[model samples]
Target: MAVEVGTTEPTEDVIDVKEVTRAERLRSMVARHRAKARKAAEQQRVNVARRVNEWFTSTDVTDAELAAEIERKRRREQHQGERELRDRVRMLREQLRAADENTAPALSAQLTAAQAQLQIRQDEDADRMKVSGRDLVRARWMKRATRIGAVGAGSLAYVNGVAAEPLLALLSLGAAPVAWLYLGREFATDEAPVVPAAVGPDGTPIANAAVPGTPFVPDTLAAMGRVSVVKPESGRVQGEKDLVTALIKAGIITAAQRDETHLAGVIRPSGPGWTATVDLPRGVKSSAAVSRVEDLASALRIKKSRIEISADTTDDGHEGRFVLWVANEDNPYGSEKHPSRLIDADRWDFWQQGIPLGGDARSTRHEMHLLWSSLLIGGLMGYGKSYMARLVAAAAALDPTVRIIVITGKTGPDWAPLRHIAHQWIAGATPDIIRRVLGVMEQTIGEMQDRGTELDRLYEEDPESVPEGKITPELAAKGMGPVLLVVDELQELLDGAALVQVAIEDEPEGGGRAKARSGRDLMVEGFARYVRVTRFVGGMGVFITQRPDADSVPTKLREVCAKRASYRVKGDRSAKMVLGDDAVANGAAPHLLGEASKGVVVLDQGDEQGHVTLKADVIDLPQFREICLRGRQLRIDAGTLTGDALEYGKEDAAAAAAALLLTDCLAGLNAAGIDRARTERLMELLAFHHPGRYGEMTRAQLQAQLRDAGAGTTKKIGAVDGMANANGYTREQIAAAVKTGK
Candidate 1:
């Protein structure tokens, strides 16, 4: 190369050789880098393989974790077992412990403390059971002496010739030794008699009998006078406890029965005697409590009638609440000086507080507010049934806004005073009177319709006028009457209706009879369905009946009349007839009422599910007349009374009488299909229906009368047997004429 370089000088081939060397160096460097990367990858693969192998074959590690878990479970179970064993050992140690000297000092101390606590508890129990030693001793000795005296009396009676005395003497002599053996026995028992409060005849509270010469003092007192006012609080407390204990001891209440009736608290003096409120146990009703009243009174050594019990449901509507009034005397309504006054002085403002029913045993006044009420008054004859009905009627009469209607089926003067205030009065049970009653009912229907329309209009105009959804005093003051319909002796009406029905079915009478019967049935159904619910609509119905049996008064009417008053019924059967099916079982024994219970009645306690004793107010005829006269004057001043009642004219009387007669005749003759009648025939038919007005009319007079009354109309009549006939008037035409007062 040195020889050629010398020859060729500088050749371009050197540059190419240098470039080739650089390229070769670059390739070698790349190969070295790839080899280093391969070594790194191989080391990583080896590390991964070692880790995986270690994971699969590490049995010692798995065994270590499993051993740790097993140790934890063992410790948990062992702890549980130790706890249970400890409890068992503790119980055993307690069982082995004793309260003797050998016992531990702590246990002995505990035993001593327990004994002392027991003694303290016993002492406290004795204190709670403590009673008046003086009263208890006196009563106990008196009872013992009474027993001894009875025995001695019986021995003397046996010496005489009294019947059954020898047997009583022998029995007493036989029991002497046994009784003497128990002579020193403690006379004080848990049960003691309740000493009742003293009350005078005028219902004034009397002082206690602890002093001499008091009226309530025991018969052993030779000289008794008025005692100082002894506070009855302590005595009442003892009485409450003793009452329950005596009841239990006398077997009126068993140990299990204790839960059935509970004495609420201490007795409280109310009215004549002490009143104790009691809570009837589960499944026991006020009626059940009432049934046990006699036994309860006997257990307390009081008269049966003295125990006045009133059973009612609690205010919360859950259990039974019984009020037991243990009176010193038998009379509860003996305060003649305190006649029941109206609950409120303002009759119009307090219409809902309607009329006073009477005063209760507790002197709480009750009312028979008939604003939205239908009442049924029933009882045996002469047992104040008529009196109660009259009382309510009189109450209605006292209100000028009330329009009174009396359907007195019986011909009596009991309701005679009602006529002065009555807008319509039917006083007998004759056929004509029955027809008049039917007319009255029809008129009542018309009145109801008119009132309903007026009421709607009034309400639409101003709802304030109809307060409480009823006819308020303001609405009634505007010449809108609150109608009251009194049906005394309702059975007669029912019987008359039934007879009419039978006659229609049997065809014994005629088509008129059929029409009359149909009308009656319609009116009765309408009355029961519509009129019964009209109380809130300003119409009230009072149905009085001697017999409230199903036949006399329909079940619909009975149910409609929600307020029932029964007095002196024959038995449970009759009582249930007036009240309800459960009346007898609910302790409504009206038959047991004595003759002295003239004004007393068993009144239904609506919605509370029982009956209560109510003494009705007795208003004489003179008082009723005064009330009627006052009401009449008020109505006149208010311009509510008008027509014949206010200013009767001869024409007005004749028109009214003719209208009544026309109604009676139309009811019978309309069914005959003879609407058009000759004047003579019409007069004859009217005479047949009501003989009092049309019976003496001649053909000319009747024609003139019909013409004057605007009942005569000209209508062509068909020729009969080739004879000319004049036009005749129809019953409808006559009725329309009567309404117009032509």
Candidate 2:
């Protein structure tokens, strides 16, 4: 922004422009920054559109009915072309080597013939723009464009007739580099780059645009689906480096070629195992590409298979993802994909948002909800939902602020973990429990509404107040903490007509003047509105369940489930029902559930623009087990556990693991970013109560246990630590403890 200023001295008669006030300047700066960001985002979208258009116009990629088939053809052609050149090179080298071995005329002839072939290959390579050649062209173009633009401008100035000899002399000043580049000789080999035939929007090749040997690039695994740094080697299995060495000895890959040719990256331990990446030479066939990805999977002891890619999974079928966690005994079923693997043809339960298997780092905690936003775990029998729920349950156990409540309809699998972390674990995701839970949530909702109202009042009262989101738990404690409601396999809640009926009976019509709104139809509608508009509460309404459809889910629940997580559906239309049309677009074949995608899910919701392939993250079962098993005794005062105290501390760790082995298991959990403090507190209680094999209690054991439990060591201290870390302790716990202690 600019402003005009008048000169006080009229003699100096010069009007000056001045910048506005500091606040205005700051706002202007912010606006400029935002504009720049918006422009960049727009440019990226334009790029994607352009790429999509290019593909759609290509011949080989235009067969929408058989896009993968077209991709396979192109890949085969490309691979053969590159391979022929490579084989010719190898033959030439071999002929030369044989000639060196013996003075044989046949070897000499072969060597000469090989050299001729080499010459031809080199010529083709130069024109074909091998990666190295592309690098040169890219570099030269940048330089040439810069120089020509600069020198051409100056030369035109001279051509158009410059003023004088003195001016002409200055004109050439600082233009030497431009002149050199402009006058430099350009070079081009005989070979020309063959632009690929355009691929259609459906990833099929366009007849006119199809390139002979282009590799099929299906950025998403459509049809089928599907943590940690727990190295998979069980002592007998080779360590990463040693295994790589062994592979080299076995002629799987040469040691010299490991980093550049075959596996381009170093071997590293990933969640539950080890893996490496291979960057195949350009123009490799689709089959070869599959072979490369498969070879790595084989080396890593992972299942090799093909997954169908869904078009609704973002425009390119490679967006909105996070993980690709492998399913095993511990996490038998998952809600969505995790960001671990880049690809998977295996059974998958869940996938993460913005994450792919074998592509990048593990998913972060804050992203868990967003990535699994489309996931909901629930089943009728034997506990399938628990497979993925453990991840959520375990997370809450570690973080106190994450107050998790697990309500399962059936007991086996879903009811396994969370006995420790979940403040209340219901073996049944039952109607009665739902009723009780609804009653509590109703209270919390009323409290939150009142708080929202109070915040408005405060703003009116002062005209300067903290924003709603800025309302901290501390402030909320003074008012009401944000309430979170998580129901597993919501089908049970749907079944509980009696409990639901009672709540309806108590519900007052015409907006009763009660402290909190009842769990009535209107209330459910209000909840829907809240979930849709308010992040603070929608964030709170991150409800989980096995059934993820309108029918399986109640009308009340469905209205507010703006975000849903899906594992696998039974059929194509079912997948559409679960993932929605825009998100799970896997062509005629629905990709999320069905026979093809057992574990993978197409995560979609009302607000989600589209779905994408996401591999689910692997859970740390050992750590989860430790938390649940020991969380029984790790007690803390909810009232006293204020501010930072709500955070887990060292005292918590020693107490929990005092009875367990001293392997860096705790470290693994922490490095994996599992709940560290709560794990400790829970472990502390387990050690005190179920002292493991250290069962033969001695005076020494008691002292050691007490010390680990944060009791002041020295013989003088008694059962204060033990008492503090007690079972069934609540708000009135201290009073009872004090009564007993005294």
Candidate 3:
């Protein structure tokens, strides 16, 4: 201990160390192994149960099953081919018997070839049957041998201790026998070859296979069974499922009501999309689905605009039926419009063939019958309201027998191209222009009356020529062409504020002022009368308005219009106003059209189907101008050019304005039933008739004008009714003055 400070001394103390036997260690290892084995066995049991369930329930085909199915299909196709060959041979023999000498040789040759082909098919079918039988026998033998071999291998493995565990040995010994018990029945008895039955196009079983000369008849009950068969899901079937699911989700139909409704037929291609017919439940109407179009689109994950639902009003049973069309593109109407058919037309036969306006959703061309009908077009601004109207005007212009009178409240270039061919082109929304519009309506009313008189005269002189009491093409060609009045921006002329005030100097009772009447009121009355009387006399009116409210188009006028076209509008109210409440209820959805759907309109031609939604033909300014030029040339060739066309840029504005005064004076005299009137009274009537031009005219000026027109000087005249004496002219004087002026 006294050696060095860094050195340590060792001291021994007794310590006990625990030691285990080899047997205990082996027991611990064995316990861990047993736990893992138990866990693996439980997992194996679960996997086996899952596999068994899947094999029983899964629709997936195994390799052997798939091969067998393919072979069966091949046999069926071969049998069908043989049957067809036999039918062809029999048909050729019949045709040969009926053939003439010139065609007999060809028929005989075809018959011989068909018979040979049929014989060859029969021989091939026999060979295939033999081969199929041999293959089946071989397959059965192979399965039996595999079962025997598996049993031998399992027994040997168990006896040689290759399977260590008792459970493993038992599984090995039992697997082959289990497979035998499960599969042996398939090979125990030989089954007859399955003969493919004759099936219809819809996969329904038909009657027994036809003899060579007999017809193949379908079984009605079996045919009905086709709808009940479990078929592999197809695109159409999936689409139908999706539609039904959407309907259910949309609350349009309940799950319990699913079987009560059904698709009328298989979904089929239509235009650029797919179409299907839905047969609704008894209490459901097609409008129910139409009203829920947006809900359906949302559930189906499609654009709302591309889904079109219309009532199938083709028959009495159509109340519960609807036609659904789903377009592939978001915008089925397309961004660009189709060119108008009238643009290239040399001359439209408006009498025999109607105007080709545009194509429907199915791309089917639709024609508008302008004869014996009036058209009312309405919509929001910039939605092709004017374009649609001008299209009609252009179509009428192409017909040389149609006299076009275009009056527009808009002074834009939308109607400029039509001016070249118009009989009376009046444009502007000023008070003067509105008065002129009223004046035009009055003149048209007079023309309608004159035409009616002429038709009556024709009916009396040559009743056969006017058999239907309507204008004929022959009569139209003989200087009695139809008159078409196209009024654009009609609301401007129909506004309540457009009034004309006139002063009465010589009242029958005393000098009193006459109440002012709006030009709108007069125009509406005149138009109503024209529409009511001119339909049979070859007079058509096309009234277009951007404002489709009640005030824009009066009820009386709208009721008389037989044809209606509505472009995109703001709401259902406007749509109903234009197309009628019944039309909208029946499934006309013009309000659904978006800004991209320019030139698209819903036309209600008073047909049983409610309305036709179509894209109007596009006639741009250049094309329209060219068409009008062509129309002008046509009118010139037919010797039918008159009115503004005859005096375009040649008539003096002041002279034309002055000339209307004499006509107004004479109209006033006729209206009052007076032979003559005082200068003050005549001026008042003139002011009322042409408010813009003559509202401020003086009595001296009117007398001077009458004096210049070869009428005698005014003098004191007794009141024709109960009025005081006044210096008025006679009706004869005014009539003579008008005649002299003309």
Candidate 4:
């Protein structure tokens, strides 16, 4: 009844109770609003996340660039690098095609490059990132398969679109600056500048954020490219073996060169950026033949000098280092060379095809006389002038008829290596000492002249068919050993006018009055005489300096020099001075050194033409890692060399003291089953390092000689004398005879 009547329609007895309480209604309203607010907040957050993601991924629009271009100006360089890589690949293929040419042995240089490329591709495929695109147009396609697989097909379709379909893929490449600003993982503002490393105005670092007073970057360990995946390819390399092969082939090289060439390591980009590394030899001395050393170095930003080279030598031993600078540049960047360097490496006396000595009109004729011509070689401070010079002395020492004498003012780095070869030296800029030494050399020359005159008188007294035709080098070469003089850092000593004048005057003086004084003076004089007329005397003179100019070497000395070479010369004037007419100087060549910048020069030894524009040779501290490691153990001072190895004309040196110290050469030879002990004893006697003296004995007497070189007393010497007497060695018979009765 109550339900039927609208006015009395209260279901539960129509109690007059308010169903909504103000507080409860407010709470309910608040709850509903809170639910809506939560959804709105979640949506807001989702939108924010989406926006952040979008910020990372750019749309396919030409103007959607956001990141700052760090090295926007270097775009040209980037393109050049890519182009060079491509061209290199092409050239290597050509080399492989002509692998059988030349007599050096049939080696397909391209095969090695191709194999290396394939190997790198395999590595990239396994570890490289996967980016979505219809086709990764700029990205290199590295795969082991000739036919695209499911993964590759999907990737290609996503990036480049269907190969058969007419679709254009708009690539979103971030500017270099933007890449660093956003994509680069390095968060700290501490980053190296785009400029090179050098002392700033306040002597602070301008680029690198490296900590002070440390050799390497703090808290940083360079990643190494290890465990590469090598893909097997067919007879021809047209696919995956492209990039690496291109790297090897980019230089003007031959298939035979590659065949004989060894791969120390293949460098490749790594990590979240363009990181790369090189795997080196076990000893780091294992050498590799490269096309353009500068290009390789520049591309890798690695040191080009200090590249310890080793090649197959004769059993007796053969070694040599020559500067072939026909294609060198003075201002490399100004030239047409791509990448401006070799393989990201620093210039450290890295050899290359240099600039043409007489511009484009250059002759390939080389007329250098190994026995008679004085050669001039130079480079900047960081270049490899000193190292290369040392190598030259080493080469000279290999000849039995050559005697090396060294004089230097380079604070020991240069002189120490040649301790065995150098008869005289000063490691620092000591003009007075150097002058006195030169005086003694002049006196020695005078004495040699006197001896020659006396011999002529004797010959006249007893007529002979051979009349002395100037008693020239040709004659000397037939009888006597040639002399070699190496001066390291002549610039430091010949820095001032007074020093130069004094040095010039000192050449005429005999040694000082006293024994040590005379000895020092004589040694110095001997060194100078070697430089003055060594070539004419069937000898050689090697002059090394960071600064080579008219000032460092006076005209009196330069007149005879027929060869000019350098790793890199900083100044155009210096380049001209060292290279002579080859490049052109202010006096002889005005516009030849037109740009007048780093790594530019011309080389002329009379008509022989050579030129090179390049940065100084930088010791490849990476490949020379072993040498650097040995630097820890290098002794600042070194004494005279003594031993069987000290024989005439041997110029090679074992520079790393650590390696020498680590192993006993004698013991090693013994282990290799060589009879070094007997030879060592003989060495002691011949070098005068042992106690007993063989001053009067001749070479013929050595057959029967029994003098104990290690004997420290007269009694012991006498005992040895008795033994020698029994063996038919007589002091009177041998000592009284001059020239061993020859």
Please count the clashing residue pairs in each candidate, in the order shown. Answer: 7, 109, 9, 87
How does candidate 3 score on lDDT? 0.71
Candidate 2 residues lying further than 4 Å off, grouped into runs, are 1-385, 393-399, 412-419, 429-434, 457-465, 468-482, 498-500, 503-539, 547-550, 581-598, 605-609, 625-742
The digit string of per-residue lDDT tens for model 1 on 43-146 reads 55564555434333432122212223333454465445444544443343454463455756765455445444433432243233222334344444554566
Where model 1 places Cα greater than 4 Å from the true spot, the runs are: 1-255, 259-261, 280-286, 291-304, 335-353, 467-469, 502-527, 581-589, 605-611, 642-742
How many clashing residue pairs, candidate 3?
A: 9
Q: Go through the candidates in order and give each one's C-alpha lDDT.
A: 0.60, 0.40, 0.71, 0.37
The number of the candidate with the highest TM-score is 3
User: Candidates' TM-scores?
Assistant: 0.51, 0.37, 0.57, 0.33
True-structure Cα RMSD, model 1: 41.7
TM-score of 4: 0.33
- Writing each residue's lDDT as its tens digit, candidate 2 over 1-742 gives 8999876656765644454476678999999999998986666566555543443343212222132333344446654664574566456545555665465666566655654554354334323422232343444455456555776787877866655455765666668656544433232232123334436458765442122232232112221111111223311122234434433543445677444333322323322223333332233322332223335335445433222222222333232211122222122223444322211111111211222211111211222442212233332223224444554444334333344445554566544555544444555535456565555555545655665676666667764444544444444434333333455555554455223444334445777643432233433454454454434531344445555456555445454455544555444455445444434432222222333344443344345343333334444455455554333333243331222223334434554455242223233334444332222343454355556643455545644553443332332222233553433212122233223333
Instruction: Give per-model CA RMSD.
Output: 41.7, 34.6, 25.6, 23.3
lDDT of 1 at 92: 38
Candidate 3 TM-score, true structure as reference: 0.57
Clashing pairs in 1: 212-224, 212-225, 213-224, 213-225, 214-224, 214-225, 260-281
Residue 224 displacement in candidate 2 (angstroms): 29
User: How high is the lDDT of residue 515 in model 1?
Assistant: 25
Instruction: Say what the RMSD of model 3 is.
Output: 25.6
